[model samples]
Target chain A: MNSASEAQYREQPAKRLRNAAIRRTGSSAFMTLLGKECLELLRSFKLVWVPIVFVVLGIMQPLLSYFMPVLIEKAGNMPEGTVIEMPPPVGSQVLADTLSQFGLMGLLILALAFMGIVSGERNSGASALVLVKPVSHTSYLLSKWVSMMILTWGSLLLGYAAAWYYTWLLIDFVDVGPFMLSYVLFGLWFTFVLTATLLFSTFLRSAAGAAFSSLGVAVLLSMLAGLMPKYMGWSPGALSGLAYQAVTSEVLLPLNSVSWWSIATAVIGIAVLLMGSVVLLKRAPAHD
Target chain B: MTELLQVKGLTKSFGSVHAVKSIDFSIQEGRCVALLGPNGAGKTTTIRMLTGLLAPTSGEVRFHSLARGEDHRSLIGYLPQTPAFHNGMSGMEYVVYSGRLCGLSASDARKRAMELLERVGLASAAKRRVGGYSGGMKQRLGLAQALVHHPKLLVMDEPVSALDPLGRREVLRLLQELKSETTVLFSTHVLHDAEELCDDVVIIRDGEVALQGSLAAIRNEHRRPVIELKLEDAPHAINWAQSFLQKSRTDELRYSWLSEAELQGNRLYMTASHMDVARQGLMEELTEHKVPFSRLEVGYSSLEDLFMKVVSG
Candidate 1:
């Protein structure tokens, strides 16, 4: 507290004892900003709704795959004596399907929810008020980035765990080692989108614009990788495909040269995206 | 008194238009200074520059007595024209968060937040979400958050300008008490607010400072005697007043004491270099001309007068 303030002028009786007891706690501004961000996430209900949506999506993936053959036989207008010879989906295939569902629907929710992570604060004048304080811009931005990551990663983990559990019950159990490897691969994909989103959030004023731009980048990368896997093998887009392969395989994924290249590029891309966001935010903490 | 903060040639430009132009001023420790200006005169820009919220196009803002290489922001508390808070946050949470940002421990921040909220008269609303707070309540909460760190300098831009009259009065009264506790630098286009609370005033117009000094000194230096008359609104009286102003403007020595005269509606305002001489001449003219009048007043110039003069001229 400043030497002259209401606390001192008005609270003189307790001043000495309080000051001695209130010696600087050495708390950093980053901790304060991070704390505020976490509170905001909880209040926004992103913490609850995002995970719920993921779980529903995750549970549906395995359940639908397991019942597809029965569903088709029941739906078609066949004679009463007719039979359908359909084999149940392999556990790994079910896991791969769950990953695809997360890749599409989960990514959509995350992009929409987090598009305004940086831009909304700027638009609402919150950034102006807080940025004027002694807090560093890096702390201000990194806090947002980290909080978004927490919600995204947490939701993904919960959803994947639910899918794994259901797959083991209704279908064959996926190999644990391969499943964990797939999780890392999928996590890297989510990280890239999150980074792209943060960068776009800083770059664009409209939240929708940020959302679409990042999604556009994701879509473009996915398309490039899907259309020409060999050419785009080192790009982050290939990681999602590698994730499917790892989940479907019975053994742990071999460290292929392309897989190493893809992981390294994705990691470096995340660093570049984060650095880009900080630089963009530095130029204008708040703008209309 | 020591100089707490000094601004040297601070300037800001938005493309071709300059919002603040090369302004210099120093804040004395414990002084409540007013940055008085009309709308769009760059008061907000100046405050933003002082708080390090805006990057000045040119010039420096150096805070004296601070540790070498220390960031200047923690030393000053800033509230914008429209004080905004996270809608989902309670007043206590926001203030405590502000305290923690300034390096207070969790327990200390909470303690300070409670005391400051009570001081700002928002103790009752401490638990309510900020989304439900009124404009005045938000302003008060803004004050509490700003003071949470006990900053040496408290900077605000139009702290009461957005509130209704009742809200305005309440915030103004809070500022009146706060100025005594901390060095306050607030900007307002309303002359009455500056006159009521600030010890010093800096009048600016068109991005440049027009006048700056102690309230009493600035008032004394620029004070001019003024005479005001309210007309009956009758055609004859209106005719007489108009002709009298025309005659006063044309005759140099005969109306030399009257420096300026302006008629807005039925009210006639006159400023005089020598009030006695002008009053005597006006009275004699009124008597001879049988000018009908409703009210007459005589007084020394107010800060409002200087503000009007500086703002317009």
Candidate 2:
């Protein structure tokens, strides 16, 4: 044990030690940090709760759509021989509605789950403890971002896949290609917003502040895109609409310039937000 | 001993308020140094800058063994004042996590974590979640994690300030053992802790270095002869004491010999530049005035006195 301690500190050459320290900014340290984050998720049961919530949300849309007519007749006081005419529910359309549900509830869960990802650790002095080592700010922030993305993408897949299965069983059949395309576009939109959450978490000291600010930003952008679709279609806020279109449209793909631009900008925006988080954390890892 | 680290003109400002002001100090290899200061003296800020947890607004922290622009974090381990852990994780897991973050391999990190936990007397509690650990236990766990990589310099900010007396003693004893094996720089408001464990002391006040040197050298340089006079609690004794205070102010020679004097109740405490002169002068004055005295004790001013004066000012 003594030899191990001595060798760890003394045996290594200076140049190699410096290189090892620098190398911590790379993938190896990122993996270690990522593993820790995953462990935290598992221990905290977020891995289970978040996905479960999404699955329930995904299952609700198709079930509610299938039973709406019967429910209306059962609940409403209608006169005898009165016919309540309603259009047939499309499977893809139901799935698109599920995406919209995710845009609200799924987005809310993710924002809250990840709001304290950086700030809590920082305010609690846990980040200060980890950051004093050879680990880099890039590795720290990237690990958090990657873990958040994994949880988000994984939950969305489970939920949307559940919705797709239910829609197929009850409503008209949807195309597999468009279903998967919509999921990716929607995932990109979620990523864009959650990246904003991570950025704000690093910049702000309060977790709630981070959550609300990012959610507000998402709301503002979506409102702008909703209000002026033609002028603001290239914004990341348009990705959710593009996701819905990818599902209901017969084209089986979103090949339009608007969708492409939204996807491109969302990816770029996520990257910039992640980079901004890295810079903020690098500036001050510990908050007083 | 060779220099391990040098901090040159390091300054940190939070808007208009300067937290640490152009502080300069250096640590020699294998020496245990204490950054001694009262609350709000910027000891924590200086330590954070050294550990790379907080970027300095100006100047630089240069490691002797590191090339310019090379990372110095690998050479040092840091423990913050109130070390918070991922409460969901066990003590063992946190240490291993810390070791791995410092670039240790899986096996090495595990082994080092085990050894350090044992060394810090937290081996039995290693499997328990950090949330369950007591303040002292958490501190020991913090120490284990900081030392897992066998860092050349271990910098801790107020390592024992939050602990009770028993906990403080336990940590101070552990630090005593660890100091011989590694270079340690820990900050503390408690002078006794600094005096008991540190080879060198850097006393800071109001974001500035008030005094700093080897403990023995500082003692020798700043030591002053102090005389304490305890008189019987009688009106005549108090009257004589009051008269002595007025005479000392008026008498230039007595004022030069007696640097400072204060009377609290029936006891008079005097700090003097020269022991013999003050002792002789007091004796003659007492005999001539026929002052009623109970006891007279002579000693030198302690570091505690210096600390109080420096910190209060």
User: Which one is best on lDDT?
Assistant: 2
The C-alpha RMSD of each candidate to the native structure, in angstroms, is 6.2, 4.6
Q: For model 2, how does the per-residue alpha-carbon lDDT over A141-202 read when each residue is reduced to its tens digit?
A: 88999899999999999999999999989987788999999999999999999999999999
Clashing pairs in 1: A2-B150
Quote the lDDT for A209 in model 1.
96
Over the stretch B1-313, how does candidate 2's per-residue lDDT look in tens digits? 8999899999999999999999999999999999999999999999999988888999899998887877888888888889999999999999998888877888999999999999889989889999999999999999999998899999999999999999999999999999999999999999998999999999999889999999999999999999999999889999988888887788877567898888998999999988888888889988988888999999999999999998896
TM-score of chain A of each: 0.89, 0.91
User: For model 1, how does the per-residue alpha-carbon lDDT over B191-226 read when each residue is reduced to its tens digit?
Assistant: 988889989999999999999999999878888999
Q: Which CAPRI quality tier does the interface of model 1 achieve?
A: medium
Whose TM-score is greatest here? 2
In candidate 2, which residue pairs get closer than 3 Å at backbone N, Cα or C atoms, i.e. clash?
A: none
Listed in order, the DockQ scores are: 0.53, 0.68
Model 1, range A159-229, lDDT digits (tens) per residue? 99899999999998888899899988999999998899999999999999999999899999989999999
lDDT against the true structure, per candidate, is: 0.88, 0.91
